[model samples]
Target: MIFTGRGRTRFLDAVTDFETAVRERDGDRAQRAMQQIQRHFGDAEDDQLAQVGPRLAALLPEVPPGPRGMVAVLIGACVERGADAAVCAPYVFDGLAEALGVAGEFCERWAATGGGDFPAPDPDAADGDVLERVGQDAADGWFTLPQWEMASVAMLNRPAVRTALEPALRTGLLDALRAVQEASGHDFKCLRYALVVLDDEPLLALHRPTGTGYLLRMTGIGDNFQLHTLLADVLIGGGHVPGQAPSAQEAAVCRNAPGQVPTTGAFNLVTPGGEWVWNEGTPTDIPVVDDVRLLVLDPPPYKRGWPAGRFFPGMPGDLVLERVLGADETREWLERCAPPK
Candidate 1:
């Protein structure tokens, strides 16, 4: 490689282009710009990633409302999916709230979805459908549950999310995932996938046993999880061409021992750290020997949580997603990052 390095140059250039597109209020170009942002950020470290906030801060004041809206949709849409962007999330979001004039809505809007005394799920309330249970569990403060744990249980809970999917795609995909778990002799309907449902907002749909998530993006006010699910259905199969901008793909998580996983779809594999062991190809050809996590372009606010949709304070938990990662899991990762304790 050459000098001065890939450092800020690459990441900054992408951000600059994004700023330009947003200033122009060209939704289409802004959307396309996200691809490069995601790619460049993936190649960067904490230093390069750290610059995201300032640029976001500077850009919001320079743009008009139209551009600001583009900024909210595209910029938020891009960074929210990649773990690499974690360093810059606070600034990125702060700028977003400033642009939208909501006085930093991130904490105010999404707090309860994770866990809080604010609008806590009614413990004594009779059982809600699967989603209601999962979302409640996410914020129950009992144990750190996986993000969207209930979603797995609610997969077939259609109109729900399962039935809304193309029948062939859903059935075949589930069978393939089931085969992997079955081969490993651990069956709890363990399949975690993120669905990119487009609306004015960003939200994720999570599965229960065979659960799925929306990987939600936000854009509206006073909306709830139902709104998110509906949007996912609308975006389910429309513009997806597998490998393209504003794309969608199914990523299966292998937590326990992975067995003979049948390759039947476009396979994208990664380590928990996001190192790509495999890339774009067909279902029949993807050959993986070790464990890996999916490297997503639009990661999420945190690794664990239901991604339940956001809502106004004093509202309800219906819109919230369940925890995707559990407490014990968080502790394991945390302990690794700390010194011997």
Candidate 2:
């Protein structure tokens, strides 16, 4: 008991010192105090989990960006599988229900089970024929739609966002990020965003490329959904790793398409939001590009719209402007560009 009291007093003192350091903007002192606190606190008896939990919580409020990236990737996978609003909605609902250990009986009853009249053969059909026929017969007075409509109940869940809508949404989102970078002094490729889902809440985290700071928000998925939602959210928000800083030679513009005016050809542009763009603007002119490009494109901006390629704003719908040449053509181009031994 005496040890416990001493531990508590030390923990509180360390916290007070850390907070004071923060108020003073003393990074070094704050870090030292934090390290000291951790050295004593990490090994605290599990019995004190309740009291220490809330006190330590304030130290790191921002969610990490790595998990957010993972969620975005998972959402991308679900979208690729042709998951529509309805299917995705149910899947997310089921996942959340399973996590919370609270099943919706009505929802379960209406859900398609293998033993139901409409089975795998008609999986492609929307809601299968069972619900459709039920709707049709209601108009003829042979049946009546339920007072508690499935769609009405569905509204409560908000469904998983539509997969078809994601690519376009993500594209615009990238543009927003790029625009942010154009106005900042930092390298855009050094920043990234991630969406995370926690039990009952959904959140997002913007990670700086240096991994020093993170911007986190409670967006809905983290507070209301399963941890899987967190995974899905991360899969959806992608990121770019920082590459070697450019040298004066690397910043020099190479020739663009033959007929282009005598502007500084094309050097690599690292935006403030952590994306790379071809320095297509004139060298003397103030370059204004969006920061969101990091989430949309890959290392070399000239590459096609592959899974890892960068996105630009030319297309009205899709994020990709056009597909680049095949593997053979790419190989040949690289070989030609390679410097002589």
Candidate 3:
């Protein structure tokens, strides 16, 4: 199952060239790259493709809209040539769900021409049991986050703040959570409450005042259902009571905090050392605060209208940490997480 040597190199080069051609709108170049990609990967055995599944999955996002038909052709060829459905799932199945608006027409054509079909699952089929199982599994192994020593902070879901934070927070949270998992060897099974306050903002803001923990408000143009369900499973294991108010202690923290009134989503992260406030989307030149454990502002993983896939690929390690913690902090975190030399 090893992926290396000239075969891997050739496959990567062909895919990269295909992406480049699509970006440049060079139809001839794209066709050539497509042919080469088919030659290298179209006939690859299931196990061979599975060996490089994650790497292949990483290239899915770069697929351009124009040559999606060609991309479909390549994928169809691979499936026909014995590539496993699991190995091709990320690009073929999940890709259709997530990027359907852009690639739907071509994917349909490919499916009609002997490629696999995309099943439209019943949306309501995702019930409590489904959420619990999937959430627990994901938290246990795949997308777990650290919960120890983490402070909880809930903010009013102001339209402005939600608008600003929506674009970056999902990826940012994912990045930060991954970092925390790497830094601390905890499996984070205790995490039970990542709320997506769509409505009931007034109740949450007035009642549940998370002093300095992970309180999320969903915005942006993507699928809120996917985002909310994913967070609910990881955060509170879907045990949280809807519209529940904050505890007395949490309320005390909110009341004691200065100027903690709800206008639009405005709250400050307070610690024994210092405080940080998120008022709007405008860039702040404030020096990186030591108390701010994690802060990320990357673009959302998929464009608007794309369904959020179950298996979202992570950003590169270096980039993920760099975005939240500056270089110095990232280096320090990495050193602490590094194994003994």
Candidate 4:
């Protein structure tokens, strides 16, 4: 997705060409346009893909059958990239099972594969049974297929829908996980944490993720005091301050040291030597001084939770070791996926 200056204009024009070709049913022109899409945005940032992929999927009906596969690819890519799949067109899921290379026989494929992870749903049990399940995070995969797609996964009551989506769901997930691991040099599960470096703050957050960050967010450290935890009372302090925000403290243990909130929702965690590691599988086990350990709130991928009021990217990254906060604006690299180096 490297489009700069005139190249940027060409990309936008290509989008228009694709739409026009779709309306006119010109397969050849549409193919060219689709290639442009993949070329210009195939590796785009999740935020960018979030905008384009679902919109194309929603227009599936107009897309030539030959190019519709790409639309499906786009949708799946959005899912894999941790982009907000919620915005995908409702009908996109209507045929997701077939689009994932199942020859339009999701159920048959599921049966043939011997139910990779789940037994085939009983025809009798699915009779008018509305399955209510909780939504799960996309990065963490799903307890149920389409866990948080906001796509018509709610149609679980329909036996056909449930049966059909399984093949595609499983197939797409595994493929995406493989892609994630290959690009990151680690397992998908390990993608949970970004090795954050306050190297600019000259501090280290190590592999501390959101669960650990929340505790740090609320806990105020003081001089010579050991906060009691179930495990033990760990001594923590920032050079003797009882009434000071993290920003006021020294680089030692100061997370929101910049005292300014990040203006964007995208953020990347980096290494102490200043390298992006959030998605590239960079090692996060490096050790740092206890006092220099920063506890910063972890951010969700992209801006999916914005309407849910999670728009703020937290104030901690303002430490300014690198452009951790503005990561999404520039996609020249792997999200700068590391904190700004």
lDDT for every model? 0.33, 0.29, 0.33, 0.36
Candidate 2 per-residue C-alpha lDDT over 1-341 given as tens digits, one digit per residue, 9 for 90 to 100: 78766876676577568667766767777667766666556444444433333333232222122121222222222233232334433333222222111112212332433223322211133253444533322211111111111211221222243222255543543454344334222222311121111112212222222222121222222111111122122222222223332222211211011111121211223333343423322111212223111111122434221111111111011111122234454343333221211
Where is model 2 more than 4 Å wrong at Cα? 1-9, 46-341
lDDT string for model 4 (1-341, tens) is 34354555565577779878888888889889978876766445566555665666667767643335446556556654554444453445544333322321333333354434332222222222112221111111221122222223222212233334445554564464444334324332311221111122233232223212111211211110111110011111222112112222223222333232222222334444454333222122322434443322233345421111111112122222221322232232223234543
Model 3, span 185-219: residue lDDT tens: 33322121221222211101110132112323322
Against the true structure, whose lDDT is highest? 4
- Regions more than 4 Å wrong, model 1: 1-8, 61-341
- Candidate ranking (lDDT, best to worst): 4, 1, 3, 2
Per-residue lDDT of 137 in model 4: 18
Model 2 — TM-score against the truth?
Answer: 0.20
- Residue-pair clashes per candidate: 55, 55, 11, 8
TM-score for all predictions? 0.23, 0.20, 0.23, 0.30
TM for candidate 3 is 0.23
Error of 1 at 139 (Å): 24
- Ranked by lDDT, the better of candidates 1 and 4 is 4
| TM-score, cand. 1 | 0.23
Using lDDT as the yardstick, the better of models 3 and 4 is 4
lDDT of 1 by residue, 223-303 (tens): 222232223223333322222221122111111121222222222232333343222221112122222111222222222
